[model samples]
Target: MTQKSPVESLIQLSAFDPVSREDPHARMKPLREQCPVWRDETAKTWVVSRYADVRAIVSDNTLWRNGINAEEGSFARLLVNQEKLDLPPGERQSILTMDDPDHARIRTPLAKALYARVAKARPKIDAIVKETLDGVAGKKSFDLIEDVAIPIPIITIARILGVDDARLGEFRHWSEGAILALNPVRTPAETAHMEASNAALDAYFTELMAERRAKPQDDLVSDMVALQAAGAPLSDIELKINLLALLIGGNLTTTDLIGNGVRLLLLHPAEREKLAANAALAPQAVEEILRYEGPVDITGRVLSGERELGGCPMHKGQSVMVVLRSANRDPDIFERPDAFDITRKAVPHMSFGGGTHICIGAPLARMEGIAFFSVFFQRFPTLKLVDEAPQWRTLPFFRGLERLMVEV
Candidate 1:
C-alpha cells in the first residue's frame, strides 16, 4: 500500500465527513489555492471553490443544467430533487430546477406573491421575533437554536402558509427530514425516515391546496391556488412542491441564518455590542454573517453541453458543486474575507445563490434576521454562549449548529 501525499489526501477528503463539515474552510483552503476547480473521482463531480468560478458556474447554464430530472421522478420534486423513491403520478419540476421559459412561468407569479407577503409581514414578523425572544428572557441559559432561532421563522412561515399553528412542531420535524434527505449519502435508517417524512409532507400540502381551492383564505396557499385556478401556468403538483419548498427552504435557512448570526455575535462580543448599541446595524450584521458563513454550503448544476468554464473544459450532463461558503471567503471579492465584521462594506456573497434561482425567501429572512437580532440583543444585552463549542451537523448541503446554548 502507498501513502497518499498531503495534497492528494486533502483532495480526496469526503464532503460529508465530520472534518469537512466542521471546518470546510480548512479542507478547502488548499484546493482554492491549488485547484480552484477540483474534481472528485469517486463522486464523478467537479467542485468549484473560487468566487469567480462559482459565479460563472451559476450563470453558464449552457454548460450546466439544474436538477437530475429522471423518468421515475414525480410531479412534486424539489428544485434539487435527487431522491429516488415512490412518488405520485404527475409531470412536475420546480422553478428552482427549470431553466428560462419554464422557470419564468412559475417564478414570476411566485415572486409576486412572496413579495406581497413580505410587504405585509414586517409588523407581524416583528411581533413573532419579540414573542420568540421573550421565551428566552429572564432565563440563565437556553438553547438559542431551539428556543429562539428555530421558532421565529418556523412560526412566521406557518402563519404565512396558513398551516395550523399547532402543527409548527410537525413542520420542523418534516423540514428536518426533507433536509436530511438532501444529504448525498444517507444510511438505511435515514432513507426510511426521509420516505416517511416525504409522504407526510406531500399529503399535507396537497390537502392544504384542496382546502384553499374550495374556500379561499388570505394566506399564501389560497393565493397560489387562486393563481392556478385563474389559468396561471402552475399545476396542482407544482403548487404543492413549491409549498413544501417554501416551508422547508424558507424556515430552515432562516433558522440557520439566525443561529449563525447569534453564534458569531456571541463569539465576537465587541461586534455584538456594536450592533446592540445601534439597532440599524442589524441588517449589516446579518449580511456579514451570511458572507462569513452561510447556511447553504453547496449547490450544483447539470452540464448542458461541452464548454469551457473557469478555464476548464467540461462536457454535457456533468455536474459541478459550486461551494458557496468557500466562494464568499474569496480574497478577491472581500477585503478581509475571513473576518466577521458587521461594518464591512462588502459585495453580496452567494448566500442566496445567484442567477434566476436566487432564494425567494430572502426578504422575509432578512426581515426576520433584522428583527430577531435587534430585539434579541436589546432584551439580553449581555447574552453569552453557555457552551463555547457547540456541535455542528454534518449535512452535505447545509451548514448549521446542532445546538447553540446561550445565556443572559
Candidate 2:
C-alpha cells in the first residue's frame, strides 16, 4: 500500500472569508470520497469522513469518547482539559462518554429527566422563543447571533437548571469562554477568560448544589441533589462535570445550529422562498439545514488497538477526528449530497450523530429547531440577508456564524 503524503495541516484553510461561510459542503465532499480516513501528520491524528467509517467508530465500543487519550497527538488535544472543568459538564457528564455500566448508571436518571420533565418544558420553551423574538421584533436590522440565537438557548437552559435571570449573563459568559477555549486559534487572553469563567461558574454551582440540598425545588438541580441523598447518586465531581457538559454542550451547540441554519436560508434565497411558499415543509427544511450545514463540523475519538478504518491501519492511542460535515455529504449515503433540498424525503443524516454516544440532547435540539424555524417563517416571511455573505465564527472545531445581519 502506497502511503500518501503526510497531512500537514489539521483544518488548513483560509480564515475569515465570508464566501466560505455561504457553503462548506463543497469543501468537505471530495475528502469524504477520496480519503475516507486520512491522517494529518501536522496534527498527528487520523481524520475520518465517509459515512461508513464515521458510523463504525461511533457505534463500536473499540473507539472511546475519552478526549484524554487523544493527548498523544499534537493537534488532537483540546487546549483546555474539560476533566479539570470546575462546573459539572451537565448532560455530557452522564455515561455518553463512558463505556458501559458506569455510563448506564449515570445516563438512566438523566434520560428519564429529559424524556419526561424536559419535554413538558416545551410550552415554556415556546414562550421563551416568543419573548426572545419579540425583543428584536420590528427592528429594521439586527445581528441574529446576539439578538436571537444566544439568548434563547441560554434562557431556556437556565430555567431548567433553576438558574436565576440575574445570573443568566454570567452563565453565558462562562459557557462562551469555555467553548471558545477549545478553538484552534485560542489566544492567551482567551485562555485567561476561560479559566476565570470556569472558576467563577464552578463556585456558583457548588453553592447552588448546597442550597438545593437544604431546600429542594422542582428544578433539575434539586432532582440531582435528591438522587444523591437517596444513594442513587452521581458524585459531586461527576455531577458538576456532567452539569457543565449539559449546560455548555446543550446550550452552545444549538445556538450554532439555529444561527447557522438561519444564515443558510438567507444565503440561498430560492430555498428560503420555497420554504415560505409551503409552511408545512419547515421540518424537512431543518433536516436539510442539519445535513447541509451541521453545527459541529467534527468530533474526536481515540483508538483502543490496531484497527483499520476505511482501509487505513490505526494504532492504540491515536486520535481520529470524525468530520461530521463530510459524512453528511458522503455520496454513497445521500445522492446529490451537496445540494440543500428540503424535500429530500427522509434522509438519515448523522448530524445529531450515531451509536452509543449519540447526543442525549437530540430531542430537545430538534424541538428547539422546529419551534424556532416554525415561528421564524411565520413572523419574518421576508427576512433577507444584509449582504450576499455573512460573517462566520473563526473557531475551527465548531461551525457557526458569528453574526448575521438580517432585515425583517
Best by lDDT: 1
User: What are the Cα lDDT values of the candidates?
Assistant: 0.74, 0.74
What's the residue-level lDDT of 229 in candidate 1?
77
- Stretches > 4 Å off in candidate 1: 1-15, 61-64, 67-93, 166-173, 184-193
| Per-model TM-score on C-alpha atoms | 0.87, 0.88
Positional deviation of residue 148's Cα in model 1 after best superposition, in angstroms:
1.6
Backbone collision tally, model 2: 18
Overlapping backbone residue pairs in candidate 1 total 3
Give per-residue CA lDDT, model 1, range 1-408, as digits (tens): 022212343223334666776677876676776778765544556677889989987766454344553112311123443453344222344565666666778788888888897889888888888788777677899888888777787788878888877777887677667756456568988878777877888898888888888998888888888887778887777777677767667767888899988898889988988998999998899899898878887777777667776567876666677878888988988887878899987557888877777788888888888888776787888778888886776655677888988878
TM-score of 1: 0.87
Q: Give per-residue lDDT, candidate 2, residue 20.
A: 38
Look at candidate 1 and tell me the lDDT of residue 274: 92
